[model samples]
Target chain A: MQIVFLLEQVVNGLVLGGYYLLIALGLSLIFSVGGIVNLSHGAFYALGAYVFVQLSGTLGFTAAVAVSPIVVALLGILFERFILRRFYNEDPILSLLVTFGLALVAEQAIRMIWGAAPLPATLPSEIRGSVIVGNMLFSKYRLLMLLVIAVALGGIWLLLNRTSFGRVVRAGIQDPDMVAALGIRLQPYLTTVVMLGVGLAALGGAMFAPITTVHPAMGSEILTIAFVVVIIGGLGSFWGVVLAAVLVGVTRGVTIYFAPAASEASMYVLMFLVLLLRPRGLLGESIAKFES
Target chain B: MKTYQTSRLAGQKSVLTRRTALKLAGGTFAASTLGAPALVRAQTGPIRIGHLTPMTGFLGTLGGWAVEGAQLAAKEINAAGGAAGRQIELMSEDSINPENGATKAQRMLERDGVDFLLGEISSATSLAISEVAARNEKLFVAVGPRSDVLRGERCSRYMFCTDIPNTAMVNAVGTSLKQDGMVDGKKFFTLTADYVFGHDLLAAAKSFFDANNAELIGDELIATDVTDFSPFILKVRQANPDVVCLNLAGNQVTNFVKQYAEFGLPYPMVGFNLNTADAWAAGVGNLSGTWPTVWLDSVETPESQAFVERFKAEYGKIPENHAWISYIAVQIVAKAIEETGSAATPELIDYLESGAKFDIMKARQAYFRPEDHQLIQEAYAFTVKDEGTYDDVYSMLQLDGAVPAPDAPLESIYPSVEGGACKF
Candidate 1:
């Protein structure tokens, strides 16, 4: 009932929201440009976490964090080249099924390698303690996580808005054929976009490793939450994801404080309300024009 | 007259040959009898014990520990020349899921040809494999699936459980709560995980509470994979019960305890047998002063001490109840094999059914009661004390008495099972 306690819960909610956004952003990018629901996005996230742990244990956490995204991006390229390339002209459901199967294979492969036990990942010594804000204390790592996510979001925003590559990506999202007619190779651009999306997912996984136990099935668990976030934010809108992430985060935090029993149900309720109000989502374009 | 006399003489000659042959056979048989014991010994071969464990799934860590305990037991038994002068060989396979469990059981039965089947951590998986044992007529010694169904309804004449059932621990905690007057007209709030094991424990605890005049105020069942428990805690605060009973295990318990403290609920929390020493050492500090029912604690006896010392020396950590239960399970199997003088499944079942008393770490003479095939042993009422400089959490109380096994009575508690559905 106390304001301070409520504020602390809200802070906790923001940290969770940050994770949702990290996952949702990648999903949104793939959906808008690649026109596919990559269910295996979560698999990439899991790969990122596992790779982070393996590399961090040897190369240290800092170095692994720096290099893991690039490594994951390369994997993304391979995946797009060998798998997604064939599905470009296939039915959307076909792509979804492919990703779903890929998710299962990835989960089983991870299980075969790492077994099923959760590997504990601790925050570095410098950031492990709590920071007092008024009467409430929040984990310093959470605060740092929020800051890192903000920076990443800002950098992504700039990448989408300011660069020539951003214009080409936006064009591809609108119409891949027109972009191809403009003499830009569509395959390489799609591959780059896929790499960026997967890299972001990997980055999110790596950052999340210290707080949560890293395990093979963690990706599937988080993937469901990410889908909820994406649906609430709008299918493939960049700003919509950011705004929806924060909204969902705050809602979850406040709900937990007031009525903890309804926390999980609250997100579903929000998504339902959003669909009822705007079928295409809060910031997504109306579907009537696209249908024609 | 000459022809008839010649025929009689031939018949007499044949009779004499038959008698000589009988005498020669008797002398040869007497000589071969002296060598029969050695030939029998050579034919019996080493006792092969099959362990089906979950080595790659959600419960894999616990399964790994169970495998370790079984391996240790086999090593010790083999070093002592095994049961009845035969070496022990353990053949293990991964039972990753319920279907996998049945497959693994079949493999152990038809392919590997093991003398006995051991290891099951999940109750549902155990129930699945119990059918395999029932059909195949293999003696299945369950290690840690504490569901009463394994012994009550799904009980096979060939199946014997080594771990304490949920009802035993629930009753132990329930009785302890009654003694402390904690259940006298107190409102009870339950936040149980939604599963068979969780529901069974909650149902048993509720019956005990109701019998002791406790009021059931509120109850909620959360999904097993729900990470955020704040909503449930908020509901608990709103319901405002005097006592809250948690029926969660493993990481869920740890997460619940941490979140409960954060939510600042004022009710005294009591967990029904799900809390263990390893869980406490991991992160039950948030519930520092709470009491939970336990089977084995380190402060109990010299046997427990020696087991803990040996486990720590080998694995570089204290053995939790999972490891201890698993260790005891293997020992019980070995004891049955030794007593029966044969590793045959039928003979092993007979040995277990004989109701012979055996020494475990806590009990002086623990034995499986034939009526239900439940282990009749002492139960512990453990209170989690502050982290010791040396010991992780000191036990505040130890209760020693014969707690009735799971099949004592289900008529008043679970009507569906008691209504001839789960009859032995």
Candidate 2:
């Protein structure tokens, strides 16, 4: 019976990890290709939730969820062109500070527009409630969300592996200078990567608005965990983030089962242990540019 | 935002830059006003008050409303005629957390030269500010924190609490639960906020459970920053308690409520502590539980309804309980200053402890208990209305009339002397 309960927690943690993957994968992708941390990635996620909430009031849930990510992805073009483009080849600290500042500005801007209150967003009626499988209980909406996330992960994997665009983006992540020397213009690839990265984050936000508090500072809260997952996964490795997200999620759940107070702290402990043993991360390949 | 002026003449030379002069002025104020009698310091000029609350965090939304309430009170007081014939000048800053809260409170006293301190939503931060006020021997009216510890063993001579304490909140909801036959022989699972506030609430809830013969089968102490509750929810399911009790605060309540609805658990839910902002954020259909609140906009009183109208007109949204508490705190302070003819700490404290009652836009006038300095006032319990009954989030809660009944004593629901633990 105790084992069954622990197993149930593991399964629930995996579902949570899938949600974390939605935000962290985008963060890792942006870092891998552009060498920018994109601190404002969470801002796009927050905007996605806000937009979904606003639109869902008028257009209903399905249409709002469909349109919110596209809207945020379009904003990614302007973000890459105006702000992110300048610090690409500069000191990493410059981009970090600028994006950090932008994150604060984005939060304040959200407060000014939407007020400093959490907006109420509800799951569609059909998707409300839970499904019981033998001894395990699962939220129906979360199951649907897990399916959506799997499809998204699949789509993203194919886009990165089997396309001409994928080849350029991969090359750009390895050596931008060599890619430019080959007349490949890595600039366009960077913008597309940022758009896709932030769009995925926004989709995470839209999907989660119903379950979490959609307020201004939510971006910063999710951003911290996203950074944790990215660090554990190592920079520039897609599969590394996927693995780290699941590990962090499962660790948190199992920790809660035994020692509930340390549930949130378990991820940091995992990160510390991982960094102690494998500094470059589980699947992180050595990138020459960042080593310097 | 009060600017202190220092006029220094060194042989007819005034060469300090504007910024440097201001800095020098702050230094001089700190030096000269360190131990001056409050009567001497507060006799002239504006009644400077420092307002510290979290402007960005889990409690930020309630703090936003708190600022508006205090601002409206200050504006109305100044417009009508300022407190004690002096303009009530406010210097507001964000009390981010406990360490920062103490630092800001120290700065407000030493550099800003505030006569009194007010406003806080987090009990941890409020406890920090109370310690600073005690060290300085300045009056601090804690307007929003509901932690019983603030009025208990941690209580200070120089601090007063305005919000309903945790014991009272448990009693408020416990009364309703008892009437509905939900108390006896019930097994309870609680998800508590893991901080001073949440711990204090859990203690009060344990007492309520013990007194009512209810059993606590399982409990989880959740961190204040946790936004996820699925793992904890699964634990609740495994425990399979008869009632799901929440001892959460701020955004934690809304997050848990929304997710609990998503999970669609079988157990009925109830909470000992809930702010109106958290309830509104959970929206209409997501939140379905009996919760205790200090005050709500739907309270049937002309003054309460008028204040709600004014708040809606100003902010384009209905006022939450934090706003009401802050607004009435300023009014209470103003009334004290006006009646005492002094803003001196000792005089104001004496007048407040004299058992003077003030209208807090409620049926019964509220007064501070001399033992704990907690305001004795009516609290109410609310249950979410059925789906389709409320058109908007603000209208979703069906607020019960004041607890302890109109004929019952207001302090009947409050923590007893042994439980409150105040020495002074």
* lDDT per residue as tens, model 2, A37-118: 8899899999999999999989999999989999999999899999999999887877887899899999999998998888
**What TM-score should be assigned to candidate 1?**
0.70
Give all TM-scores, in the order shown. Answer: 0.70, 0.95
Q: Which residue pairs in model 1 clash with each other?
A: A260-B230, A260-B231, A260-B232, A261-B231, A261-B232
| DockQ scores for all predicted structures | 0.06, 0.50
Model 2 CA lDDT for position B90: 79
- How many residue-pair clashes does candidate 2 contain? 0
The per-residue C-alpha lDDT of model 2 at residue B238 equals 95
Please give, for every candidate in the order listed, the TM-score of chain B alone compared with the true chain B: 0.80, 0.91
State residue B174's C-alpha deviation in candidate 2, in Å. 0.8
**Residue lDDT tens for model 2, B23-92:** 8879877776775665465677789999999988888878888999999999999998898789998787
